[model samples]
Target: MKNLKKYAKAIILLTVIILLVCFSFYKISKSRSSQFFGGLTSHVNTEEKIIALTFDDAPTEYTNEILEILDDKNVKATFFVVGKNFEKYPLEGEAIIENGHEIGNHSYSHQRCIFKSQTFIESEIEKTNTLIHDHGYKGEITFRPPNGKKLFGLPYYLNKNNIKTIMWDVEPDTYVSGDADAIVKYTVENTKPGSIILLHPLNGTAGEADREALPKIIDELKAGGYSFVTVSQLLKYEN
Candidate 1:
């Protein structure tokens, strides 16, 4: 009986340790600034009233509308596009380039990057890079993980290839989804100098509020004396 009780306590302790490790990894995977390897930029450090507007999962049907709004505002934002989507919507991808915006790889399959094989991570990023090149995007290609998820393999590959993981400091769409007013308020309130603002305005009907909030966010920021630039341009201001 004594031996059985000891074994039961050992098992419980082991289970608790395992759970704690898993929870830690979960938090690290989604962290915008922390990673296992490579350089990650959530936001640049500068006092200039300049920010980068980044949109994830692009080349959707709503791309043109978002581009039109940016054009009207005369803003150059960054688009992190998926490989399959870019392949499917070549014209939309081209339109982004034609309008002179920066492109970043958001992976080919758009799968979570945590606990994935190195080969898988390599393929996802390289394939997307090829697609972006084929589409004639002639700027420095940064990368943003799908769902902002990353772990050992993804960061290692990025570090090996000398690519920076682009993340955002201001993500209003996450806190106030589908509420244009709330998104605008949240973004305008949270933005600071050198802030990297993230949005998902090209995600079909689900992103309508983000789309509506985009122009307003731009106007509000510009009114507050913030000039918009692409992610690469924003990196130049890193201090």
Candidate 2:
């Protein structure tokens, strides 16, 4: 009976250890500010009233609309596009490059990068990079993981390739998905100097709200004396 009790305790302890390790990995994978390997940048530290606006996923058929908006505002933003989408709509990708905006890799298949193989991670990034270059983007291409999820191989590969992992400090649309007014309010209230704002006016239901909020957010921020910059440009101002 004592032996059975001892075995039962051992099993419980093993289960607890497993749960702890799994929880740790989950937190690390979703962390926006830190990573186990390489450089992870969510926001810059500076006194300048400067911020970066980054849009993730797809340079879709609606690319021109966003480009036109940015053109009208004379604002330069960063685009983190998936490789497949860039190839699928090369002209839209070209349009982004032509506008002199920055391009970032948002992976090829948009898969979660945790517990993924090194070969798979390398292919995802390198292939997307090739597509970005193919689209005539001539600037340094940074990376933002799909859904901001990364843990091991992704960060290690990015480190090995000398690519910066870009995240965001301000995400208004994420909090109030499908509500343009709320997105605008949240962004205007939360944005700080040297903040990186993540938007998604490219795909999904949140795209509509984000697109509508983009101009309002820009106008409000401008009134607040905040100027917009590309992600790379914002990083330059980091101290």
Candidate 3:
């Protein structure tokens, strides 16, 4: 039955090709600043002495401390908060706005953005955006998927709906240990023109370093003549 053997081989080859295409889609979607559809704004390309300080995760108990430091330094930053985290801590989310900072939608559940359905992707972004709005955040709501991952469905929706995907160019806390002084030093040493720095000051004990590093980072950056802007604002200044 040579014909039967040929049919079997054909099936196997088709399967292999299907798997390869799926894997490629996965890789492209999960890229930090890449996509197959719409616009992806990770970091700006500029020589101006401006940078964006973006924080991911909750408006946790440490929100007040961070806001106070930013206030004293006379700098404005952006907070990308999750829908569920905001639901769990509504006051902190509101405080982010009350204290005069930009707010972004991280996701509804802070789940990974790859290998998920279109409905799931839609819910993750839309629900968080709704929640952020409920908390009185009326600014242009940009987005940052959890862990900077996105696949086709997420980007397609974001692009179609005109939502900008934000990522960071410098993340010292994420690379090194999440310690306050350590992160502060790393940020100071690594910051460049038009850099978008991501910080996680909530979600766990690992983020405490960001809390400690926030004030110092602000002071140092100001001293170095770097002004903080929102991710969208930073994009406007791109070269």
**2 versus 3: better lDDT goes to:** 2
Work out the TM-score per prediction: 0.97, 0.98, 0.87
RMSD of each: 0.9, 0.9, 2.7
Instruction: Write candidate 1's Cα lDDT for 108-168 as tens digits.
Output: 9899988889989999999999989987888889999999999799999999999989999
For candidate 3, the TM-score is: 0.87
lDDT of 3 by residue, 1-239 (tens): 99999999999999999999989877776566678777777678888899999888867777777788788888888988888878878888888899889998889887888878989999999888888877777789998888888876787888989998887878886577767788888989989998889888764687777777888898888899898887768888987
Encode model 2's per-residue lDDT on 2-79: one tens digit a residue: 999999999999999999999999999999888989989999999999999999996887799999999999999999
17 Cα displacement, candidate 1 (Å): 0.8
Clashes of each: 0, 0, 2
Candidate 2's C-alpha runs over 4 A off are none
Clash pairs, candidate 1, are: none
Give the CA lDDT, 0 to 100, for residue 65 in model 2: 90
Cα lDDT, all candidates:
0.93, 0.91, 0.83
Weakest lDDT window of 10 consecutive positions for candidate 3: 25-34
Distance from true position, residue 176, model 1, in Å? 0.9
